[model samples]
Target: MTAEPAVVAPVLPAALRERIVAEFPKYPEKRAVLLSALHFVQDTFEGWIPQAVVPEVAALLGLKPIDVWEVIHFYAMFNSEPVGRCHLRVCTNLSCCLRGARGIMRRLEETLAVRPGEVTPDGNFSVGEVECLGSCGTAPVIQVNNERYREGLSEDDLPGLLDELRTRLAEQDAAKDEE
Candidate 1:
């Protein structure tokens, strides 16, 4: 039988490596910095953790590949594949569910024409269900890009919220293009 060809791993950028290294002192050990390193890499890669980078992160942290993989798979905040420019995570736990979260989610699916865990055709937006955004008082919340939380949403709010997000992203893109 013929021998198998070697698989090439993607290179982590110097700046990103530096950033990860910078996080080292904040944590007690390199292993403790894994989450932050994963975040830096994910943000660098535009919102998802590519599988090829897992080994790189493991090597950087002096941990096993499985160690990195475990954390990546365990966290809902981490995406293992490509996502849209805006990922809308709607809270679906009991508190939010009782407060019309499902309706809001359905509206998002219909409006975006993509079901949960799928990206829009233009690659601009995606929707997914998440548990306990910790805003039960403001149930029916949507976390935008895993950064900002939009709380107290009714089904009536989806259209405007989506439009606002689209406009904001477009403006940000325009600014980047000018730069």
Candidate 2:
């Protein structure tokens, strides 16, 4: 019989480990700190949570790896795979749909040459459809990198928005390079 290969846990950097450990005091139980710890790791990995880190997180929280996996899977915001630098999410809820979100999504696909849950060839942007951004009054809204929201959008607004986002990302990259 062949033996299965062992899995090695990825090492969490001291700073990041410290940050995650700090959250333990805030929660009643170690397991309760899972979400915050996952967020910290995801942010470190630029929005995607590495599969290898699952066990490590579970170990830190005194939970099973499946427990960590369950939480990650439950939340749409936590990505298990890599996404582009710009993860653009268009809301497709009733309010957004009524406000022409479908057209906005089409425009994004056409302009970015990538559909929902896809990244551009150049690795600049990825598109996704989210249920809601909670701005019903704003209707059609898009989130950039899960951080900023561009609300009250029309299909006509997408092209410029894409260009603007690309430019801003480029500038940020340049600044990081200089640093």
Candidate 3:
């Protein structure tokens, strides 16, 4: 026996719907647009892809919920749960590890007061380990919010880096509030 696919009503707003639809022509098939659609949906919500949007994306893309889930589950970029405004993904791949990635991870956990896979009390930061970010030349790299990378890290650099991130998060919050 199997559970029925969710009967998810359309939740995507007109703007986002248009954005996803606009990408249709660029792809060979509607199904091919799933990845971009997921990215748009995730960006619109938070850093993570909400479960509700999974069925929604499937419906819009003319695919099954399972199809969407497969992509989401396979991709490290798509978070199933809400992450902090600052999602610090430390690369623990071989090159980074050899270059002191573990020390960087420890410093981040200690400075943020949250272990990997946990959000801070203030909901401003979270830490997680990831595979190669493709910056072996700049080993010990940490990717922030999937947008920027700080490479060649040192334990001594942790304090200032964390402080900069905190300030940036605060600024982002303030800008959001102004809107």
Q: Which one is best on lDDT?
A: 1
Residue 145 Cα positional deviation in candidate 3, in Å, after optimal superposition: 1.1
Q: Ten-residue segment with the worst summed lDDT in candidate 1?
A: 3-12
The C-alpha stretches of model 2 lying farther than 4 A from their native spots are 1-9
The worst-scoring run of ten residues by lDDT in candidate 2 lies at: 6-15
Candidate 1 RMSD to the correct structure: 2.8
lDDT, model 1, position 112: 91
Residue ranges of candidate 3 with Cα displaced over 4 Å: 1-9
Tens-digit lDDT track for model 2 on 1-179?
98899878567777888899998888788888888898899778877898878888888889999999989999998998888888889899899999899999888888888977777887888989999789889879999885868999998888798789889989989999999
TM-scores of all models?
0.89, 0.90, 0.90
Cα RMSDs, all models: 2.8, 2.8, 3.5
lDDT of 3 by residue, 78-98 (tens): 888888878899999999999
Model 3, position 121, has a per-residue lDDT of 81
Give me the displacement of residue 106 in model 2, in angstroms. 0.7
Residue 28 of model 3 has an lDDT of 81
